[model samples]
Target: MELTFASYNIHKAVGLDGRRDPDRIMSVLREVDADIIALQEADRRFGARASVLPRALLDDTRWRPLPVAKRPRSLGWHGNALLVRRDIKCLHAEPLDLPTLEPRGAVLAELDLRGEHIRVLGAHLDLSGLRRRDQIKAILKQCTRRGKMPTVIMGDFNQWGRLTGAMQVFGMGWQQITPGASYPSARPIARFDRIIATPDWSYETSGVHHSATSAAASDHLPVWASLRTA
Candidate 1:
């Protein structure tokens, strides 16, 4: 089976124009038109954690947000969320505990995409390089505890270099699919946003989803991959 997957950090819908516009974010999503999308900073960083993008807006699309335990107003777990096409079957969704100096964590799902089951994890790792390494260790440990399946993990890594040590952690059973620069969408030079598929799968093609709207939508451009199970 083949799937189009994307990961984005919406920066709470605050764009280059310094406006908080959910509609702009929606436009970017519509342009990507991915089967699965991982989002970071979908909720406000303070207070009740109100979602920047309303549920109604998401409802209007063909996508459904993964059901995870969170505050009624919160869009995701620690600002990490997953969206799957309405036709995709969500077997389970859960929040992951990650050690961070700042509030940060991961969300994962076991989804049945037309009978092909796979685990998809979405995360925004901490900025501190050391903490990022520990967070990756925790995530990998959780993947081991969870039942095995072809997996796709994507999100803002906050790492500037491709040779960063933190990335080495994913080398065990994952293959980097999209390494194109995604940060600062207007002039991306760091590949902060990425998509990695389990070794059991391969990518047909992958790259950063860039456009005029996406550049104005957030600080980070969404990265995507066309992946297929082995």
Candidate 2:
């Protein structure tokens, strides 16, 4: 089976116009139209850490978020959230704490799609290079602890170029799918957003989801990949 997965940093649902419009973010998501989506900065930075994209609004969408929130108001842990198609069955979901100077975490989920079990990890790593490598090791450890399956780890990696420090840690065991420059949605010069998968899956196509609405929705444009079992 072939499935499309996307990773987006919604910038807390704030656009380049300096407007906080959750609807616009939804519009971009619709345009991407991926089967699964990994979101960074989906929740507010402070206070209750409530989600910028309200749960009520997402109710109208085709995607359902994994129940991995730590707080009643938060959508996911540490601004990282995972969303899968409404038909997908969530087998297991957990929040992971990353080693960082600031509040940084990752979300993990096991889903059953037509009796096919798979894993998804959503993360937004730190700005510091050192912290990012540490975060990757932590995430890698989690992946190793889980049973082998078709897995995808995606989010705003915050890495500037293609072959960078943190990505190197993932090494040859995993395949990195960079859909090109996805940051600064207006111009998209840096590839901050990315998707990584194990050898169990092979990619069909991948690219940045750029459009009029997407460019206005957030600082980082969404990156997507089409993949099937190897």
Candidate 3:
């Protein structure tokens, strides 16, 4: 089986022009066109955490969002959302807790694709390196508790330099697909987004989704990967 996965931080639907347009964000997502997409900053930072993207817009697509919203107006937990293709069956969905100075978390979704079980996690890490490490540790611990499967952990990692030793938490088996510079979409010089899969899977192709629309949609461009499972 081959799966196309993507991770994007929409910056709460605020474009480079300082406009909050959900329709424009939808257009960017349409361009991504992945089987599964992990989104960060899907909700507003204050108030009820209202979703930046309208429900009607999402319903128009072939994608179905995981229900991890705590408030009626919110779309996700800590502004993180997981969206899977409508054809994919969701077996389970939950939010993962992380240690952070600000409101930060991840969403875990166990999906069934033609009877194959796969775990997908989406997260947005803290800007501080130290907090990011602690959050990653917590995520790794959750993976340990879930046992094993074809798992993928992806989202805005906020790590600019090399992955280094911290990524070893996924064990030597996991493969990291380091997509090219995705930050500051206009003139990307940092790879702040990432996608990693367990040893059981291999990425046939991966890269940053850069386009004029994408660059205007948010500060961080989306990263994507094509995974092959035999």
Q: Estimated TM-score per prediction? A: 0.97, 0.98, 0.96
- Segments of candidate 1 deviating more than 4 angstroms: none
Q: Pick the candidate with the highest TM-score.
A: 2
Per-residue alpha-carbon lDDT of model 1 for 106-129, expressed as tens digits? 998999877889999999988888
**What's the lDDT for all of these models?**
0.89, 0.93, 0.89
Ten-residue stretch with the least lDDT total in model 1? 170-179
Query: What are the per-residue Cα lDDT tens digits for candidate 2 across 13-65?
Result: 99999999999999999999999999999999999999999989889999989
**Residue 23 error for model 1, in Å?**
0.3
lDDT of 3 by residue, 1-230 (tens): 99999999999999899999889888888998999999999999899999999898999998988998878998899999998899999998998889999999999989999999999999999888888888888987898898888999899988876556355555566787888999898999988799988887877999898888999989989999999885
Which is the winner by TM-score between candidate 1 and candidate 2? 2
Misplaced by over 4 Å in model 3 are: none
List the RMSD of every prediction in angstroms. Answer: 1.0, 0.8, 1.2
User: What clash count goes with each model?
Assistant: 0, 0, 0
lDDT of 3: 0.89
Give the winner by lDDT: 2
For model 3 the local lDDT of residue 60 reads: 98
